[model samples]
Target chain A: MPEISYRQAIKDALAEEIERDENVVVIGEEVAQYNGAYKVTEGLLERYGPKRIVDAPISEAGFIGMGIGASMLGVRPVMELMFWSFAYVAWDQIINNASSVRYMSGGLINVPIVIRGPANGGTNVGATHSHTPENLIANMPGLKVVCPATPYDAKGLMKSAIRDNDPVYVMESTLLYGTTGEVPEEEYVIPLGKADIKREGTDVTIVCHGPSVSVAMTAAQILKEEHDIDAEVLDLRSIRPLDEEAIITSVKKTNRAVLVEENRPFCGVDAQIAYTIQNKAFDYLDAPIQRVSTIDAPAIYSPAVEPEQLPKAANVVEKVLSIM
Target chain B: MVGFYREMVRIRRFEERSLRVYQQGKIGGFLHLYIGQESIAVACASLMGDHDHMITAYRNHGHALAVGMSMNECMAELLGKATGCSKGKGGSMHFFAPDKNYWGGHGIVGGQIPLGVGLAYGVKYKDQKGSAMAFMGDGAINQGAVHEAYNLAALWDLPAIFIIENNGYSMGTSQERSSSHPKEGLAARAEGYGMAWEIINGESLFAIRDGVGRAIKRAHEESKPTILEIHTYRYQGHSVADANAKKYRTKEEIDDYRKNHDPLNVYRLFLLDQKIMSEDEMKEIDGEAKQEAEVAAQFADESEFPTVESITEDVYWEADNPDKRTSEGRLFFND
Candidate 1:
């Protein structure tokens, strides 16, 4: 195992999938010669030819839909939506075709594709570039949504998504690209619909995913060190087929829960996690499920507002403290 | 090529029955019939093998049936029955039969263009030899997605047959009014993509069959994408429910097209001239089609409605937990 940044982990997973499966292809705006908008696809076009590492014109619906069709025909395409906010333009393709292809076709065709991109508010990207995919695609049954908090999870989960026989939405965070974690050097895949318990505790469960998972872990450390409160942390690697069992078991043990997400409070992933805790682990509840989330506002370019718009470790700790 | 006449008959009956169902309020949503465009789908589909796939816009009843979807499932879909191809969730505008390799009857204009390209890419990836026949209306050529898909298809040399059903109108706004250069709709744009192109009369079954055969073969064999502009017409308005416009064109224009260019009549006349079948046999085929349409309609009328549970089915491919987990574990605390 070796420590790598979340960005390097994604690049490694893509390179591995492309190397292992000739049928696997990557396409998106700025994904080719430029490596990627975020360099997630660095050194791919040179490794595979331009045909496999496609540089699609800026047409999300067009290229993304094309990826869906290619998947139907047997090509496993990994498409990039650039940013989660711009995914709206390709809703027709993702929602109507990509998500419904299997259902509409009576399960005859599998849209074994991955639409990956950076999501969540951060670093002065403004309203157009800042958004989360929790409510947007979580309800869509045919799509599998995953967001990896660390490099290890990013590589493993991405490999699994590319190999799975269904469409997957891989939400990356713009802010966490430099963050590093230990990753296995050998080929491996983390199954979807599974949760990783980052830390174990009996006082409270702080569940989060993607960039916010790191935030939750940091907050858990402070809770344990300063308050002597051991807070359990659950990383929901996949959002769609949410690992309810993992969250419920953690809540049952802790008796109190604090759901953490970087998305806005309204219709956010935290809301869903909190709801699940109450329903499945109601008897074990010691207090209401507290949520650590960004305020309901468009991400502002100002550093002042950006900090407020994103969930910080301080916020997570404070929310857990209030609930406790 | 396996079942040309049979497919033609099935589609004619399917479209006619669909019209009847629409009249009776059995079929809902936008219902674009492929009555006159049958030859285009049939001739082109006949040239394709199982390795090939097809994708099209909402005028897809003929394509679905031609590609091997059962007439009963199609009709049931039109009637919104539980047994419909889409499990009764999708109506006419959303008919999709992936098992048959028919991608969808996509409602969004030019939405399937990219998906079609992707399917062709997939075919090549599987080490299979074939092209995806992506059918779009003349109206769809103006859509930005069509241009994007075409450029990528040509650039990648993905096995794709970008077929434009140049029916001369975009839902009443004739190509003349809608497009700057109507005569060379998508074909003119093909040059920019650096791809070879062909134009054929959609009503001429021979031309359609030959042209599509060449396109599919060139794509599969040469791995080069080609654009075939099939000059066609839609007998009805955009959908079944639209009134045939009194001002769109002259009555004479409509009459001439009806008399001389009816694909079914043209094919029948050619068949008679060639002695492929007798006049009496043609009449019998027509009668059989009408009877078949009646039976399909009857089946659809008697089919059961999808249960409440069906709302959750088909959304995913999981063997168990068909209802797609409804309740999210969360609480709403109002301030």
Candidate 2:
């Protein structure tokens, strides 16, 4: 076992996959020469050469669709979107080509492409650049969505996404790149639709994913020390193949639930979780399910208000207390 | 020569039969007939070798037939039957036979362009001597995705052939009303991307062989990209639903194309004048083509619709193979 940064873990998974699969190639804007916008894909161009580490222009629709097309012919392309927000320009390709093509074509085709990049809004990057589209992308059925919060989960999930036989979208956070976590020095993978209980308790359940997972963990610690409320924190690593069983089981035991997410509240990923908890574990509930989410508006650009806009440990604790 | 004639006739006859079936309310959704633009697909498909790939827009029944897609599956697909190429999942606008290098029958106007470049990219990546012929209508040229594809193709020197089937009208808008008519024609826009460009009279199968043939060679031998603006015509409306086909233009113009630029009549006349086939033999071939279309129509007419149990089929690879499903969740959301 060893410690590694989340950014380095992603690089390791990519390198390992590239070494194993000849058909795997990295295609994106500045992924090669520029070493990625966040320096996540540094040294890959030199290691794998131009054929494997391809640099695409700032045309998300063009290169994304190109990766999908190549994937059909067995060229496993891991497409990098500089920011997942840019994916809106190529909505037709992602929705129609990448996601629905296989189903539409009656399984005559398969788009084994992985679209991965930063997808959080903590920085002061304004309204457009800051978008948490995990819910939006996961809303589509033919696609899979994964958001890795820790270095260990990041390595495990990135490898799984590349090898998965469907179109998998990996949403990472620029804020979590430098964060360190323990990762084993052996071949391992984290399966999709599985949740990890970061901390164990029985008073209340704090279910979250990606960036919100850390906030949940912090809120759990605070609830124990200040309010003396022992909260169980559940991290959903994969979004689409959502771990409903894990979420329900935790809620049943705790008898109370507080969902924390970085995205908006209107039809957010948490909305699905709330519905699931009420639908499945209605009798087990001790209180109505509560949610802590980013302020219901465009992401603020101010350094002061932006932090206020996103869900905080204080917000999660407040939600937990209200439910208690 | 006779083989080409048979394929062209088969496609034309198939389209006519499909159009009839469409009117009869047997086939659902949009049916884009490829009545006049037959020789272009016949010639283009004739040139495809071991590694060559082909993709086209929604009006793709012609290319599907030209690439050897059996009329049974294609017609069944149009009729929304289980035995269709896409198993009734994709109707007229999404026919596919990937094993034959026929990528698909895409619905979106310039959407297939980038995918075509990817096909060429895959070919070049594998060191295969192949090219991808991505076909689009005249209206698709204005789409932003097509230009992005053009830039990528030229920038990478991908073995891509962008075949713009300039059929004069995109849905209801005519070429004059919709596009900029440069001196060099619509495909002159390729010049902006520094890609090689050409124009061919799509009425003649011979002209397609010479023009599309050259572009394919450029892609295969030099791993370069080319844009061929093939001047073709469509006798049918955008879809069978486009009732304003005659209102957008005059009856005389449509009649003029039907009489003069009809690839079938022109190529048949050329074959007869060159002594490629006798008049009696040509008549017999037409009879056979019509019979084939009739059989396909009969099969599609009688075939069963997909089963209710198979409604969620083909959405994911894991759905079909539960044993190998890596993720643990409900792939299908049904009651």
Candidate 3:
């Protein structure tokens, strides 16, 4: 196993897919020459040339719509939205054409497209820049939303998303881009909607993803040593095809649940997980489902409030202890 | 010009039969007939090779029939039967026949503009030698997406021909009332995007053929986008709802346009003067076109509607499993 960062895993997946299929192209702002806003496409431009690596104008609506048009002609495009905040300008293309084209076409077309970008709060980018829009995308029926918490899942799931015949929304967190983990250097893939059980325990089930998955794992280890409460941590890789069975199985085993997310509290991913738990396994629960999420407010710029707005290991521990 | 006269006759008789079917409640949904813009489709279609692609606005029955879409399929689609081009799913507004290189008969006014550029991009990306034409109405020129498409096509030097059928109205509103400047619509707008522009009278088939030919050649040779504005008018109301459309425009104005600028009459006069077609031959051609449209309508009337049991089918790409209940759970969330 080779250790790689989350950013490298995404780059490797894109590179491999492009090399495998000549029809696969990448288009975004600064994707061709500047490598990408986050350097995730650093060496792709030189390898693929200008035909495969397209640096579009600053208009998100124009390029994203162009990607859809290209996809209609049998070219699979992996579009980068620069940042999650910038996607608002092209919401018409994403929601109107990208999400609804399949159902509206009555199965005559398959949209093999991916819109990848970094989401969630960190690095003091202010309110407009920092947002975790997982729930907003998950609400759409035609889109498949995936957010990998580690390097292995990022590489494997991204490869699967690129090959899938549906539009996949790969929501990455800015905080998790540089984080490193063991990634296998072979022909392997982790299919979409398969949840990974990070640690096995019997007392409490902790569900998380993206950057918060790391916090949940750390909290699970601390609870095991100090509090004497064994916590089960499951990293949910995809939100749209959410692995509800694995979640119900864990909840059925532990009899207690704590849902953690970095997004705001109202209508967050935690609410969906908590709702599913209560609806599916209400009788199996020992206590009411508990949620640990960022506060419901515009993210403050100060360091003091930023930590509070982010789901931390200590907060996960507190939520898990409270539920146990 | 002779070809334009025959195509206009065909379009006129086709739509006349269609209007009758619609009156009898045989056809459903919004149906925009291309009666007045006959010369424009013929003139522009003359420039397209078999390898090139074409996409157009909702006023598309004539274009689809002209560009090799079987008259039976187009009529069946209008009748909302299962044998239509989109398998009876897309009505008069949406018809996609990829085999004939007719990308779509899109409903959105300016939606096909960017897709035309994408087709041109694909042609170039695949190292093919052909130009793509995107036809839009005068009303669609006001959309923002069209401007974005123009800029991108110019920025990339894409070989795309953007033709605006300046029929002087959008639904019920006239161009003078809707737009700021009445003179220069899409042709002048192309100048801002650094593309060449041409303005031609759509009533005159000779002028339309010359203008479209030059535009296509320029797009192919220079590898640059071109905007061609064809000044035309619609004889019918916007759709079936416009049967009594006297509130929008005066009857006297419609009479004057029909007398002076009717594309079929213009071409018939040219053909008669050139001794290419006699009065009897023209009458014979009109009768043949009427018979063809009548036969197509019969075929559409005999077709059947799709069964209701296939409602949940084709929602996704072949991921059906008996154990999964929800659509998403079957494909992405399988245990």
lDDT of 1 by residue, B254-326 (tens): 6777799978778877877888888787677778777877887888889998897666556655432335422
> Which has the higher TM-score value, candidate number 1 or candidate number 3?
1
Question: Each candidate: how many clashes?
Answer: 10, 0, 0
List clashing residue pairs in candidate 1.
A66-B114, A69-B119, A70-B118, A70-B119, A274-B330, A275-B329, A275-B330, A276-B329, A276-B330, B1-B46
Which tens-of-lDDT digit does each residue in B241-285 have in candidate 2? 999988998899999999998999999899989998999998899
Of all native A–B interface contacts, model 3 reproduces a fraction of: 0.23
Query: Taking the tens digit of each residue's C-alpha lDDT, what string does model 2 give over A69-98?
Result: 899898999999999989999888887889
DockQ-based CAPRI category assigned to the predicted complex of candidate 3: acceptable
Model 3 C-alpha lDDT per residue in residues A1-324, reported as the tens digit of each score: 889999999999999999999889998999989988898999898998998989989877777776776676678889998888788877777766676555444456666788998987867878888877888888776678888998899999899888877788898877788999999888788888888898999999999988788889999989988999899998888887788888999999999999888877888877878888888899999998888888778877887668877888888888777766
TM-score values for chain B across all models: 0.92, 0.98, 0.92
- For model 2, the TM-score of its B chain against the native B chain is 0.98
Q: What is the docking quality class of candidate 2?
A: medium
Model 1 chain B: weakest 10-residue lDDT segment is B326-335
Model number with the top lDDT: 2
Per-candidate Cα lDDT values, in order, are 0.82, 0.92, 0.81
Q: Given candidate 1, what's the lDDT at residue B140?
A: 90
Better of 1 and 3 by lDDT: 1
Candidate structures ordered by TM-score, highest first: 2, 1, 3
